[model samples]
Target: MIDISASPTSTTLVVSGDLDLAERDQFPEVTARVTGLRRQLVVIDMCRVTFMDSTGAAFLISLADSSRNRGGAAVLRGADARDLFVLEVCGALELFRIDRDHRCDDVPDAVEEPSIV
Candidate 1:
């Protein structure tokens, strides 16, 4: 289960989901769409992401590669501790722009629309 959307001004892709084996297939389509955008910011919002597997990690790496190829930025926001650890353990954390903000004690039930952007 994944919810993916792109920012209109920048090439930011907001993603929220489990992103494990069950939702791996949707990532490529998302990357394809985000990589073709005209903007330079590919911000992947992971605030609502609860799980991640090796396949999901690979998809993120691919997205980073594509963003770099286009000379854009790939920003990963609000990754949970476990998922961040997964990326670090896989040595994929350095490949993208990541923020480890866990200040909120209460996480939303779902990923809402990009109201901040």
Candidate 2:
């Protein structure tokens, strides 16, 4: 499942469970809310995501690319070893803005409120 939230200055997407072939297509819907923002900090929390494949990595990389085009940044947080491996194999580890020190309360603007399901 996925939970999305937005603060004054940032948007956060928390993804748990597995991100394999079955879950790969869910990226667009999850990222749609933040892809158009400009100068916004987008945080994708994958700390709880148990499994991820190259498809998942590609989706994330694409999402991050889209955000960058709009002057926003996509920060990936808490990617475990398996997920990290996919990213590394794809040579996408350096493409994203990794922020391990991100704090939820630290927002800079007021964005639309997010939801969880």
Candidate 3:
């Protein structure tokens, strides 16, 4: 599941549950909505994510790449070692700004209703 919140300058994607091939069908739509925001900052809050596979890493990479291509940035907040490892193995760890200091308790209510995919 993912909950998206946006401000004029940034968009936050609060991710939870499992992120793997099972969730691939939802990736495109989520990607389009997020990228369409055109915010300068994209924050991916992954503290609640229990598992992530290569497909998840690919989705994250795509979001980061899209943000960078538009002169923006993508931030990964609260990613655990397992999630980090997946990104690392995929050679996409450097694509995002890792925010170790951010906490899930810091998330605000979604500006847009939470979308379960």
Q: List the residue pairs that clash in candidate 3.
A: none
lDDT of 2 by residue, 1-117 (tens): 778888888888888778778996677777676664443677888766768888788878887787777777788776655666688789887766665554334333312222211
Total clashes for model 1: 2
Poorest stretch of ten by lDDT in candidate 1: 108-117
True-structure RMSD, every candidate: 5.9, 9.1, 7.5
Residue-by-residue lDDT tens digits, candidate 3, 40-108: 899999877878999999999999999999999999887877788788889888898887666566544
lDDT of candidate 1 over 11-35, digit per residue (tens): 6545555788888667777777766
Ranking by lDDT: 3, 2, 1
| Maximum-lDDT candidate | 3
Better of 1 and 2 by TM-score: 2
Ranking by TM-score: 3, 2, 1
- Winner on TM-score between 2 and 3 is 3
Model 3 alpha-carbon miss at residue 15, Å: 0.4
The candidate that wins on TM-score is 3
TM-score of 1: 0.75
Query: TM-score of model 2 relative to the true fold?
Result: 0.76
